[model samples]
Target: MPVRSPLYLLERFDPGVVQLDRELRVIAMNSLARRLLPVEDKQPFEKMVLSFHPERSVAKVKFLLDQAECPVSNPPPMTMIINIPERVLLIKVSKLSDLRGDTTGYTLIFYDITELVSGELPVQPMTPESLSIEKPAPAKRQLHKIPTVSQNRIVLVDVETVTYIRSEGHYTWVSTAQGSSFCNLNISDLAERLDGASFLRIHRSYLANLDFAEQILRDEGRVSLKLRGETTPLPVARTSVSRLLEQLGIGEVDAQRT
Candidate 1:
């Protein structure tokens, strides 16, 4: 009987080993790999990897591996995410080669990263606008110098004087310390005009001035804001809570409350 090579033994021992050909097709997969992927006994491997959404980390790995000066002999491991219906995988890719100074392919090892992606881990808060998932509110005029309003003439008001702004149909109503004014603008448009640090979108219909905000209150995923000069409290959505807390420099407060 012939003795097995150490490399072959190592491949068999690995819990998450996936072998791919030069064409990025899956040539072989280990037991763990089979469990991780949704593959049938007769299905092609390359098709499985390509079915995944183009991920940034994976693209970077491909780029590095394709480089002419790639140090495949001692290729550094790479981390990436692979999205599957049930969960997202956090994968590490390592290069594998033959003994005769010839490149073979890659070995992929990965596990679930659903918790990390879901903000279960400590992560920086990001606005919906930043994600490009939702349109931001329209910008209200800044309140630097008070605007001169005539009895019949319309005037633009400073956004800083406003305690909060609400969306109503085709126009947004800006509420200030003095009074409220109606303007023909959408919330998304308004959000772009105001400074991100000064204004915060708490709810789909509301944007509050953080400088004028007194404090934030949370109850079972619900958030409410207390403005410095306003008697009424503002409601915040659960999705906006983290961003609001981070904007107010009160992330610690939210963490403690949670």
Candidate 2:
């Protein structure tokens, strides 16, 4: 994996606004947009909006722009959530027009929602094709590939590569070595769907894969498990600690001795 850019540390809550001419050329941008984007690294003026984005994101941005050209009067803004490096952005595009109804310009607005996602995980950019899976009727089957949402696109992650899963209200955030993505399935539903032999409910909000287990950390009587490729240790509930250790082939006595 490549080193994460320090720019990911910038405040994510602030809104970034950019203005584009009818030709889709960058006209202006707010201070926040300059900081949030690569405006300094790349020339902004006379550059097409697509040029400002990474090659992988260009198609999605173009789609958003295309969707904004609604024939009806007072069309709603086109919205999408996209991943860039270590950040997740919620973007909206609104079209502008002259008095005669001729297209004038556009306003592109975005918010960084990285905190709502997995902390410290670089969000992997997903393609539109990845998001186009047909929804089939629910059935009881072991999950080999889990579907996750990133940039309004669905990404299929292989189950073996997953490190952990965290509950977010009814939805779940699936974590892997690359990054985390939002999964529509609830934790309980996922627990039931996933292979019991591979995943364990270590806590009410956490499901851990024992294959990634690196070490069992005990601090002040509380137990936490450090997973491979993950920086933070997952809290192991008091009740689940022994089970987790046993699953790792570590007896309680052996764990205490270590």
Using TM-score as the measure, which candidate wins?
Answer: 2
Instruction: Give the per-residue lDDT of model 1 (tens digit) for 7-120.
Output: 343234334567776666787887666654446543746654554434433443454335522565665665443333333344556666678856677666655433332323
**Every model: Cα RMSD to truth:** 21.2, 15.7
TM-score of each: 0.41, 0.48
- Candidate 1 residue runs with Cα over 4 Å from true position: 1-152, 252-258
In Å, residue 46's CA in model 2 sits off its true spot by 53
Count of backbone collisions within predicted model 1 = 19
lDDT (Cα, 0-100) at 113 in candidate 2:
49
